[model samples]
Target: MRSRAGLVAVCGAMLAAAVALPLGGTAYAADTAGATDAARTAAADTPSALVLTLSPGESAQTVGVERAVTLTCTPSPGGSHPAPQEACAELSAADGDLAALPAQPQSFCAMIYAPVVVTVQGAWQGERVDYARSFPNECVMRAQGGPLYAF
Candidate 1:
């Protein structure tokens, strides 16, 4: 039918435009990398913030280890952490479920008890997360918290 033929032509044109748009965008980006870097810097500086602390215990409030990192997960994740990409990947893998981060195998943990507290507070995937958990020791924290709280 003529209608079917016309529909195919329209679809073909739409597909071509869709393909061209991205190629055009790449060319535009190539042309504007210097100008865009400032904007990108500003965007990166925008806070997707998280604060992590490790303390001796829940009662002792002075932090033994602290890391304040800003994460940007959109358009590709990046931030100030030592392992930004890995941290983002781990968080993404957990779907922002901090509790879902797999614990290290029991075999890896030493039978030591020095009471360590781990705290995480910030926005993750646009939702605010405030979590504080005290583990038996540093080993326990590492065994349970994985890389997101490793720092």
Candidate 2:
């Protein structure tokens, strides 16, 4: 009975630590291209390091065209994302900073007001990541988000 009580206490402490980690974690945003060297290195050292949900959001349901996919980086970068390799490489280049992804501005876009909210929510190198943004329209979204949501 004494051993059993000790085991319960140890398990409880571990559970508490796990729950508190995210509250103290960093956003993993990059101030420089090299800022994520640690995370990138960690990812390379540990296979299958990134798993994120790339989405075009609820408005897709309204149009019956959902361009949502699960993307896995490292260990070959594969998932439902059409161009997983490119997407993963792009993400790695930005060091998991979704806002820092290079912009691929469209040549032109109709002045439309169809708002589209995009999101990338997942883990990067053991750190929590939650990102979301609203764009004026799909064209604008493509221009700003680049390949991350080009699916």
Candidate 3:
């Protein structure tokens, strides 16, 4: 009888511990919530940074072969991007997901197979981003990416 009672108490204690644990990380809600809030606040305060690179691999452009620029959305969208305001707005509208940016429907481009590769490297809203894509031409890139790639 004594052993059975001890076993039941131990099982109850274990169940209580499991219930109190937050995702099995911190042992309590208060601690986990505080840490999560601190991390979110830090991320928000830090200026979001991203580097945009465009390479005219097979494009017929003559003046600039390769171009790159730094973009910061937070702390007022300060960067070397040509259209920083528009770019930042578009990015925010898309929730930092570059691939989700909507493409313009009315925009038309030539069928030339001039491949222009573009890359975005860095962090967006504290989330690491490494995006790369090859557009058939610069026009398609602009039509699809909007002011974000207009730089």
lDDT by candidate, in order shown: 0.71, 0.68, 0.85
Ranking of models by TM-score = 3, 2, 1
Among all windows of 10 consecutive residues in model 1, the one with the lowest summed lDDT is: 59-68
For candidate 1, give the lDDT of residue 96. Answer: 72
lDDT of 2: 0.68
lDDT of 1 by residue, 1-151 (tens): 9999999999999999998998799788787997778765664454555666667765436555544555555546666656667777777788677888887565387788888777778776456878878888887777787777666
Model 1 misplaced stretches (Cα beyond 4 Å): 1-47, 59-76, 105-107
Instruction: State which candidate, 1 or 2, has the greater lDDT.
Output: 1
Worst 10 residues of 3 by lDDT: 56-65
Candidate 3 per-residue C-alpha lDDT over 1-151 given as tens digits, one digit per residue, 9 for 90 to 100: 9999999999999999888665766456666788999987887776788999888774324335388999998878878998888998999889788999989779999998877878898998789998887798999999999999898
Model 1 clash pairs are: none
Per-candidate alpha-carbon RMSD to the true structure: 11.0, 9.6, 7.5
For this target, which candidate reaches the highest lDDT against the unseen true structure? 3
Clashes of each: 0, 0, 0
Best by TM-score: 3
Q: List the residue pairs that clash in candidate 2.
A: none
